[model samples]
Target chain A: MVIVVATMPIWLPATNFLTLTDGVLAGIYTLLGLSLVLLIGYTGQLALTVNVTYGLGAYTTAILTVDDKLNPWLTILIGVAINVAFALVLALPLLRLQGHFLAVATLGVALIGFTVFQAAPITGGPNGIDGVTPLSIGSLQISSDTAFAYLAWIVALLALIGCRNLISGRLGRAMQAIKGSEAAASSVGIRPFRVKMMVFVLAAVLSSVAGSLYATYTGFVSPDAFSVSFTITILVMVVVGGLRSVWGVPFGVFAILALNAALQTYGPSLIPAGGTDIPIVGYGVVLIVFLMFLPGGLASAAQRLWRSATGSGGPRRSMPEIGGAVSEESS
Target chain B: MTFLFAGLTVGAINALTGLGLLIVYNVTGVINFAQGDFVMLGAMAAILFAGANGHRAGLPLIVAVVLAVMCVSALGGILERTVLHPRRKSGPVLLLIMTVGISLVLEGVVLVITSSQSYGLRNFTPGPALSVFGGTVSLQSLWVFGVTGAALVALYLFFSRTRVGKAFRACEINPLAASLVGIRPSRYWTYAFALAAGLSALAGAVIAPVTTATYDMGLALTLSGFVAWVLGGLVSPVGVVVGGVGLGVAQGMVNGYLPLGLVAYANAFPFVILIAVLVVRPNGIIRSLAERRV
Candidate 1:
């Protein structure tokens, strides 16, 4: 609400590309954050592969749109297809590992993704792929910042609705059951493996959408943007925003962005060294503080404030378990 | 012949890393992902301490290494007892994220204090080449192998002969049962943390001379150790040692035999190995062997 009120004029101003870019980036985060919440928050899987999935999406779109000269609509579909296939291949065995082992394994995936994108010449290596043309609909073009922002938010909103529908349906209940106890869920006829794999593919596809939008917005894709640290940052957002709630995703992303902007704009002069690198330090501090104290995430905190102001509790969602609660015998 | 010795030298370092990882994993049921960062801290501390005292030549290198390990071990004990143990019931995902957060803070703090430039540890070995069998090797490489071997033997003895070590293993296998037997679970965690940190310190002290120390070196080391642990099997010291040696030899051979373009892909070895093992042997080599025992 404050964002709309504060940036009302910038949306239409000719020199407002920077503000438009920020809004589009926030929109992309919404998609990434929502996808992460679906797997991590809803299904209780601690996946560290969001950024890798995002990179895959971007790379897929880049190759199809630029190298192959595919249609914009076709490129998006191809991107989703690639991510889904990757997820299926990864999910079959990757889902068996639990706890820190799973986290480390996923971290390895992210690192490998970075290495492949950085080392492989076909993917443009370190310099990254450039000249990615924006999506066009006849006369309408998505090259400008304002158009990109609106398009990104539209896709993000649709994804949010799709997630809401899934969570509010039978599949949602199955996922929740799986989250609470895989053995019990299986006993009750819910195939825990199928549910996990479904969620993995779903999350990967959503992340791919965001990645494609991000590629269109930037007109470039680099390995640097999809490093392991990017994965950590996205996890921090989900954690800070409250993992279970649907609305918490955007709240987390904007909070992180606001923090980033604040540090970038104001932190340099405050430091004796007088440099722009303190934002990295700030992001690190924010993550530590949030994890140490606000374990339920920023979403829960936001709900608390809303309830206090309105003199009633807002709709509350049960805090999802962070990982699998049921231990399975590897028989 | 030197390639063989290089394999052993790198293998010894990997073994030390795995030893640290096994200690923490056994006690806490949580892998300390920040283990490599601790190793980085150890090496950085030694370099700084050396810088402050290296001019005098009065402080012996052995004493400096001991002090560095002591300080880092203390830090480890404090972190485990206070920050980590307080939220033990939160499960492993949060613990993993928290450790990652801690790693970020440590890396940043290291950068803030010392800058991001890599440093070299002063080598004390005799410069002359030593001959063995039909081959010649650097004296320093032989020392790395010897020290790592002694450390492993000591660890073996400690676990087999000491009351605390037995209690620690008991705690690992069944925490509630061990607590009933009057072993405080928290104390075991402290011992694990201290021991893990000490192992990291020794790894840093030994390898920094060869690899050069940097703030970010810990992540790479951690990845190598992680690959070795997963390959050999987590929580098995002998498996870790053997895995470390095997991995080092594999890496050495790749470096020696692979073409120029593939050599640039050498750093990808650990990750490729990790993905393959996770996909093919999620239970790890030792666990699979043990599973077949039944």
Candidate 2:
């Protein structure tokens, strides 16, 4: 799959499928999805503010690059820093709330973030920032859709590897333990609040990176680009993609993106009005319907298929995980 | 004075929306994100039946209002049965996400129906605005307050006096025990959702004139309602009423005080108070009389 994605620019000219832009987005979305899974699936945060973090990242990149003339690469670090600060401020109040309370508070913060993005002068208000500095490594400017796709995937892959390690490491276990039972986790000497805060910050940073990359690729950042609905869409994508395998996220991202693309391509023609909003209903329904059939998400279904395919599995993975996240999470 | 009246008016509507969330949560432990969508539907439905919003139904105002409420309530019941109840066994997180789906579907359908046009509903009783405390309150504001008060009174009576309402409380206490007592919790679940929907719809019908009905209004109202519910401590009716009113008043103050340059952010004012409350009093300002679910 990596090879196919890596070599896609070579063979893609021969085919009629125009997914090069979606490829870039899917890569970025994979990072966003992974970050979400780390927060909700693994860390038990159930956050609805991923969009804000992503938007903050994009805005940070946009502001720094456009106003300060800072290198786009530098803005990635700046974006991460901003997201951490934002997350820290939000998590301080949020840590006190749990379940629906946490979710609602985060949703509120996200709304506030959206308002700020739309109204604040720094963010260019509702118009957003245009003429964003494109990402480049030295003189080798990362221009063209194909190079951008590679840049996104490489970052996504690196983030995926980092998250995979985090999931298996001591801190990751601590996060999982907290998710299961904070009381039990703390009894074993884990500070639940501290761990939860760390995970939240980490997720924010990841979202920020994805958002920054997205801004650079698009060469624009606006309040219109970041919305609560997009946050929900990301949540749906991660959930419907499946929660069991961190590796399955990209596949889920692509599938959901494809579903969206198909809807966009055909929705307006079939429907009389509201073509732009049709994809959301389709995805929302897909999330609900997918949960009905595959509660663990498509990754779980994939694991099942792999199990039936492999036949001999004792502590062995049903499928290959992206960046070597295989076996441990499997049954 | 205007701020106070505005707060009271929107406060009443927020209270209704919060009640919708509260009732459904009490019965089913699910936060219906679609509650605001129901309110939007009710307002739109009322407009449609009243021959407003380019609709030619031309029904009488009273009949149109009744039909709107009834239709929305029925739709709520149908939604609970088909979309929510089937997924009752799933985790709360999944169910919450499902309500989001329901909301999106509703909003999408409405957007398609209205082509994204905003529609105004004629005031229930056309009258001169009342001057009180050096400010004039629209008649619709009176209707909002009146309907809310009557709804609360009716709810109090229903819960205290009606068999089904008691059974709903019973179901809230213990679904297993309620089922054992031949009080079908499933059936009551439908009723609770329908009741919540009816309450929200009624709020929409009254405030339709003040705010107008739009396809996208439901999502923001849902958050405001949730904030009101959370401020009231998620479990208690009294808490939500107070919380809703408090939030509304707070919002009124923010809108009153904030500079015109910053007024665009006033939509986030209630949430600010909500988060502050969550930080200071995590259990909510109005703690339950008895121990409740955290």
Candidate 3:
């Protein structure tokens, strides 16, 4: 499945379906979804700051490459480092918060990040910076649509492999233990704070890397691209794909983006009133429906369907319960 | 002095929005992310009903205001009954995301209907500005403050003296116990949503004259109101009011003293303060009685 998706640019356009640009977007969103899975799914931290981190990475790469004349590849590293630093600083105060409080705090930080992006003159004040150079090695530039698609997919694949390795190691067990019960994890010699901080930084770095690639690919960075809606879309993708599965990231990103594209392409023809707004409306409806009926998301649904079809299920795989009751007392 | 009055007016609006959030949260244990949209709905509905800004079929201002509030309240009731009530057993994260979806849909609908245009409502009573403490205050600002005060007083009375209000309080205290005493939590949930919607709409209507109304205004208002709610610890009404007003004043001061460049980022002040407060006192400035015992 990974090989098929990674090599999609080779054959996707011949079918006259999704373009190379869509592939690039799918790659970016998949990176974001995977990063979110690391934090929200694995560590049980409800964070909404992914978009801001993505913005930071984009802006960093855009400004560095455009103004400071730095190498695009080097800028990506710098952006990731800066994002990890920011995440650590943010996590210091934020790690203490739990549940809705943590979610709200991260949201506040994202909102603040957005306001700064809009207000800061260095960010070009909402118009955003342009003339972002594409990624290159020596004199060979990866600027074309097809080339950027390959670059994005290659990086996405590496990130996926790295994340899968991390999840299969001791860190993954620590994350699952912490997510299950922070108290129990700590009592059993796991440092919840350290594990949570590591996962948070890792997620931020991954998101920043995706953001840097996005800027490099598009050659422009705008405030509108990093809005709360973008964050919400990535979140929907993570939840819709299946939170606990690494393979769910690509599935979620591809499904939602395809749905959006299909709605945009065919919706207006089907309904006279349908226009650009149809995709947004479609997204809203799909998110709500999935949340209501398929809480474990499409990945789990697919697994269940496959098992039932083969009639080989001795016992059903239960969904990972994410609803840990944490302090319901109103204060 | 001018900043103080400006802060007071905005603070009153924030307080009302926070109160709306507090009410729903106390009853349902879920934060209504769409609270600010209710404010937007109130303002937009009033504008449309009053035939303001090229709108047809003008109604009397009082009648328009009442109709707008009622419409928004009914929307809140309908939303609670349909989308949320069926999924009440879902986790907090799912419920929160559901509210976000609801907010997106509400904003989308308003955007389509209003054509993404901003609208303004006429002040309650247009008149000359009054000079006080070396600062001129608009009559509209005074009206905003007056309405906020009256609403707060009325809300207090409703919560303390009325039977339905006591039922709301009972649900907040203990939903199971409240149900045993013949108070249905679901009924109060719907009521709390409507009440909060009405209050937020009222706030939006009053503030519309000053800030104007736009479909996209909900998120900012929600964030600011949420900041106030967090600062107040999400429980006490009086604390919410104080936090709201204090936040408004701090924002006013930032705008007054900061550089032009910094002033452009003044909207983030409450959020920054919210983070700081949460870090220092996760329970907020006013701790609940149960928390104090620990």
TM-score of each: 0.90, 0.94, 0.94
Q: How close is candidate 1 to the true structure, as a TM-score?
A: 0.90
The residue-level lDDT of candidate 1 at A296 comes to 61
Worst 10 residues of 1 chain A by lDDT: A322-331
**Deviation in Å, model 1, residue A310 alpha carbon:** 4.9
Count of clashing residue pairs in every prediction: 4, 0, 0
Q: State each model's CA lDDT, in order.
A: 0.77, 0.83, 0.83
Model 2 residue A210 CA deviation (Å) reads 1.0
Retained true contacts (fraction), each candidate:
0.34, 0.48, 0.43
**Pairs of colliding residues, candidate 3:** none
Chain B of candidate 2 achieves a TM-score of 0.95
Residue A286 local lDDT, model 2: 84
Question: Candidate 1 at residue B35, lDDT?
Answer: 90
Across all models, the iRMS values in order are: 4.9, 5.2, 4.4
Over A2-59, each residue of candidate 2 has an lDDT whose tens digit, in order, gives: 7977986776444444478888898899998988888877766778898899999999
Ranking by lDDT: 3, 2, 1
Docking class of 2: acceptable
**B95-174, model 2: which lDDT tens digit per residue?**
77788888888887888778888999888888999999899899889888988999999998898898888888999889
